[model samples]
Target: MAVADLLALINEVILNWIRLHYFYWANWCGLSTCTTRYLVAMAVADLLALINEVILYWIRLHYFYWSFLAIYPVCSVNDVLRYAATDCSVWFTVAFTFDRFVAICCEKLKTKYCTGKTAAVVLATAGVLFCLKNIPRYFTQKPGTIIDNMPWLCAMVASYYTDPGWVAYDWTDTVLTPLLPFAVILLLNALTVRHIIVASRVRKGLRGESKGENRSDPEMESRRRSMVLLFTISGSFILLWMTVVVDFVYYQITGIGNNLNESQWIFTCVGYLLRNLSCCTNTFIYAVTQSKFREQVKSAVKYPLTSVLRRINKSPS
Candidate 1:
């Protein structure tokens, strides 16, 4: 069952604007803590995913008025973009997890590893790597049309059964997309937690309560809160990504096609909702959990509206 078009469109708009605003605020404030480039890259990935979703919904629609639409070239292009965006989005989250890991667990190396330049280099590498990885998608998914319940379907012509590379590729993506990232995130978060506990005990054991040391405690607390925010985001990611991974893993291993049974259809619907919902949620998490982020959002929202009002008030009637 497809999501209603109007609701999907509304989701696209809201996700797009809020993320764009967050990006602008992060940049404009020159916030060392928040302006990490991975966040910006993640925003771009989310928008790309949202746009791909809109295009996918449009392509999936089978209207009686346009029964003879030619999809030979377009479907392959759409698949390439969709695959690329999905890959980039997942890898960006992985990069963020690495960022948080270095920041919290490896304090001695944090200055070297967690800088903005380093983040940019990592994000760029991930983008290029995933784009190259999904290049085969463009070549393999030849476009054609098939009739489904009298509605023509823009379909891929690739066959996983005949092509061993296609089968390998599907399995590789399945591992990279969810399994590896989830494992890495869990491992890194655990390490970070252990480091925090050790550091807290050391601080408690210290004899001198210098003014500088006292001030640094708040900074450590702030960093811990940011780590918590990352934790929530990763948890959301795992929740959203698990079902699709399971569905794909099951299909590839068992060669069982989803024939729109009640269970399978429900699985698909939940996957779709989770995938899109995951893209927009980080911004909300930031807003609710990060006080600094909330302040930036207020300024981002206030200045433009205030300027427009001032312009209106000064204009001659």
Candidate 2:
């Protein structure tokens, strides 16, 4: 677990730093401003998720046993913030998917809906809504332990399991997150793929490819690049979150809260592990799918060593 924490911490910090710089400062990646904003938003959300979900939780749980954050009200607030970050990270991917779907399939509407202004508005609206939605989560926590007249750690209030309101909220929260995002991304990607296939055939016919005239179709090439970027990012997200999606269904159907058997316990833990891992994967996806992104990453990597060498050469030795 310590190693896992260290790796996650390192990955989130380093990769997101690189991603932020590449997406924000460099236009070499050839992505539109709207797409850049979505990527930046996702990176920021992933960093916050790592800080709240992994770093802060780790300190409270293991290293700093009596940390104030583990206390009742503080713990509840932490839980709320964590959920908000997770929701933002998950939904940003959905936003990016929908943006791509519009650009690829709905050409007429794309000009209006897929601008930087629209991206900002959509992200702000979603962020505020999710933050507000998760406020009720703060009430669902209780002290996990009482020691020397002090409450420490957080546990779900018993009523969260039994009360109708809390139960319904729980279901809604789960559905609003990975489950709904999962379905929506899959549907959007499916439609996008179908559109690409039909469009490709039409394009080849119009270009005289059926009569054996070979030519470079710049339009199709552009669409292929967009499809590559879209599919890699969304595909990584779906694959990583698949376990969590399944575990949610299992938990709801079985209603097995505390008495999970060995296999079930492991399964639940693995789902959580993968969910945390999802926060660190998009930078890799970008590197894999975008050649310009790879060039930028390599330059970013070499800049430090290059700077040091330049400094040594200029020194009076």
Candidate 3:
């Protein structure tokens, strides 16, 4: 069964159970409440998917079969998690892109308009939209469907591979969602680059000195670093998504290129593993490439460590 179907099935089962035994929980949990729970659940799912992918990749690289059975459950859960994570990721990416757009384009109005309250509202709105968009699939189930026929270990949504609605969903997911953010980022990057170049030239002209003499200007250096980081992340985003697009196209055009019947389990598992890895790669890139992010992470860890050290130093030895 495809990941989406498995997720839909799992979501259906969970929702049904919640409705049956936990009526109070359901009543008290509004859309925002459910969405928050879903987002956290999706993050956990993505983490599991990452681990499963790493293990599967290791096994495949080493040509191991002994661990296959043991890893099956991990792989299955990974798929369901992947579906949930993908949905959460889409919403999060939209939020991130919008945040960047506002930060870059509306610098003057940011303090007044883009406060934490505004961000929270935007996130809540996105969560609602994402849930509503995907809610239809939960009700559209059939007996012996793709998800039902899968291993009986756990309930999962079946893949609606042949469903016409899926094609529409694919367009929305693969084309519209990423492309919109990408376009906005590209435009902002271009404008920022152009502004920096113009400012550098003007500063050099006003200095009554050769451009080479002022090449080490602090402002110019900062701008250069900022541009480099922006381009690096933008490039990574494009590359990561391009791989997904290529994979989707290949699947649609060639109808499972690698003989699924012969290599059914391994091929499906590996493909999913790679896709999940691609999604997780962004977090690493941000940590490694962005100086501001690195500093924040350092401070986050160092503050606690420093307090502990101070307490130890003040205590009787």
Candidate 4:
């Protein structure tokens, strides 16, 4: 079910990207110029996430044969998948943040700087950085050990308290994965709100421009609404991630409780659900809050069906 959910999310993202670039040119005015780069980055992230889900599913399904499988498998495949997923997520978050930052801050310079070529370079750089950050994990190895009749496939630096390299990995994942992304998003959202407030105030201060006059500018209003929606989406992301972040910190400081307890399992399940839910929630947010996105969806459905009908009508008897 989790794998299915993740795949569905990937599909949603692909559909949204298609709508933004191919169908809703007027709404996503600058998207076509960078569609190739954006799609490539999204594909990389989606593939990594799918791999992670598959590995996790395998682990869960084969838990009964853990003793046999763990010994036969010299390395923990699931851990490797986890590393890949984290790397992909880092790159995806950075790309999304940078895209938003450029769109908002350099609105006037869009044509010059935010082109497909530039986007491609940026995404490629992010991917390289993500891989470099996580490459150490591949070299780290855990001594084979037996636990509860099951061989534990441990990493040499799994415990950060003892391993300097794992400590660095922990800090990097904590900061780059959630902290930095959330910080940048919060700052951008604050600036957007401030800009809107100042504009509103200026409009009110002017002699001829009344509140009604300011409100009448649909373009300005739409931009403001979009920023608000972006902020809400970012807030939701932060909220969903906070659970996992807290769990990480708790494990780092206090460590997991003794015994393989049911409470621990419940917490783990909840954290996993929250993390995956973040990916799924974005589609709902855009669909519900953004008029442009809703319109894009409408066009995506309508245009394709209309084209198909036309082709059928024009077919030879």
lDDT of 3 by residue, 1-317 (tens): 55467558656855664353233222332212423333233333344345434443345436643333224454444443334445555445445544544544466875665455665576667655655665554333332223334422223234545557765675665555456666766777777777677777788888666745645578667556546645665666666565555556666787653345655545555655555665576545533554655676788989998999999999998
Best by TM-score: 2
RMSD of each: 7.6, 6.3, 10.9, 7.4
TM-score of each: 0.75, 0.85, 0.54, 0.68
> Per-residue error at 158 for model 2, in Å?
0.8
**Best-performing candidate as measured by lDDT:** 2
- Better structure of 1 and 3 per TM-score: 1
lDDT of 3: 0.52
TM-score-sorted candidate list, best first:
2, 1, 4, 3
In model 4, which range of ten residues has the least summed lDDT?
Answer: 65-74
Residue 191 lDDT in candidate 1: 82
For model 3, the superposed segments whose C-alpha errors exceed 4 Å read 1-81, 139-163, 177-184, 206-209, 215-229, 254-271, 290-317
Which pairs clash (backbone N, Cα, C closer than 3 Å) in model 4?
none
Query: What does the lDDT come to for candidate 2?
Result: 0.85
- Give the per-residue lDDT of model 2 (tens digit) for 1-317: 76477558766885767576555434767678888788888877887787788877755678876666677777788799889999999999999999999999998999999999999999999999999999999888888888898887888888888889988998999999988998999999999999999998898887768656768988888888889989888888989899988998988898986678999989988987888898988756755677776777799999999999999999998
The local distance difference test score of each candidate is 0.71, 0.85, 0.52, 0.61
Please state the error at residue 24 of candidate 3 in Å.
37
- Please identify which of the two predictions, 2 or 4, would achieve the higher TM-score against the true structure: 2
Q: After superposition, how far is residue 23 of candidate 4 from its true place, in Å?
A: 7.5
Q: Which candidate do you rate higher for lDDT, 1 or 2? A: 2
Better of 1 and 4 by lDDT: 1
Stretches of model 1 off by over 4 angstroms after superposition: 1-23, 27-30, 33-35, 58-70, 146-153, 207-216, 258-262, 295-317
RMSD of 4: 7.4
